[model samples]
Target chain A: MHFEYQVDGGNFSNAGVASSQFKKILKQLNVDPGLIKRIVVALYEAEVNIVAHAYRGIIKIDVNIDKVRIALIDEGPGIPDISKAMEAGFSTASPKVREMGFGAGMGLQNIRNNVDQLDIESVVGKGTKVEFEVNLG
Target chain B: MLVSELKEKLNLKVFGGNSGLNREITGGYTSDLLSDVMGFADQGKLWITLQTHRNVMAIASLKDLSAILLVKGQQPDADMLELAEEEGIAVLGSDENSFEVSGKVFNSLMQKS
Candidate 1:
């Protein structure tokens, strides 16, 4: 099964909608509880990244028999240094975003920790694409 | 302990999500960072934080948390109360700081266990 959600940048109010919906779908499909928990964490972090940094973004989720793949593509000021952004304490979020208890620099690390595979591609001044897959087996 | 029991035992004020007062609490986590709680908090735990935004309710619901206890007499945003009511995740409040509230909750849960 496949599903997609649009994320509005700078909108903290709608940040977790995709993750919540995806979690319901996973529950309906009877995915293992442990796997669902990991996927939800990765998905929520990816969703928040777009809300915090991108101009706009799309989250595409594809679920197969053995694994689930999530792709987050955003139009924004792309990460200039992927390596630095992947570091646990690096972030570019504005003070307003930080005030909401977000933008603590743990978003990408959380995604990496929860997913089995992670791939990221970015073009400075244009956009970024992050894809991750979790083994459901 | 059930959420209602904790609220009664701790004298917490109910801000919203009264429907979830009966939800069982398995553990507790205290953090002000949204991503930290999102990454580390487990299901059925009660989250203790000072954050009072609508997104806190989102995280509580997405995490399947039993409840959210606001420390230091913090109150939820208006929209946060609305979402908590809709999602049925209890929004609780206390006059104590996170440290005191967490210690009390820990002791309570330990006693039950």
Candidate 2:
């Protein structure tokens, strides 16, 4: 199954909409509970990253019988240093975002921790593309 | 323990989501960071935090949390309460701080175990 969701940046209230919708599909497909939990964590974190930092984003989820692939591609101020951004407690988010208990710099690291394979690519002035996959097998 | 049981024991105020009052509480996690809770909170846990936004309800619903107890007498935003009701995850409030209420919830869960 293939699903795509659009994310509006700086819209805190709608941050998790994509993840929630995908979760319901996963549940109906009888995806493993543990696997669903990990996907939910990674998806929500990535979803919020776009909402907090991007102009907008497109989330694509492809669930196969053997694996699930997700791609979050966003248009925003891209990361200058992906490695530094992955470090705990390093962030470029505004105080307003911080006040919401987000932008604590744990987003990418948390995403890395939850997915089986992950990739991130960015252009300094353009945006970021985060892709990851989980083996359902 | 059920959410309603904890509410009575701790004398918490129900902001909304009454339908989830009977949800089972397996334990509790206290954190203000959204990602921290998203990464660490287990299913059926009661989240104790001071962050009162609509996303808090999003997390609670996504995490399969039993309830959320707001700290420091904090009231949830209007959207937060509405989402809580829709998600059927009880949103409880407390005048106490996170530390105080976390300890209380800890004891309550421990007693049950």
Question: What tens-digit string does per-residue lDDT give for candidate 2 at B14-100?
Answer: 999999999999999999999999999999999999999999999998999999999999999999999999999999999999999
RMSD of 2: 0.7
lDDT for A114 in candidate 1 is 95
Off by over 4 Å in 1: none
For candidate 2, write residues A32-114 as lDDT tens digits.
99999999999999999999999999999899989999999999999999999999999999999999999888888889999
True contacts kept of 2: 0.78
Candidate 1: DockQ? 0.90
Q: What is the TM-score of chain B in candidate 1?
A: 0.98
Q: Is the docking of candidate 2 incorrect, acceptable, medium or high quality?
A: high
DockQ scores for all predicted structures:
0.90, 0.88
Extract clashing residue pairs from model 1. none
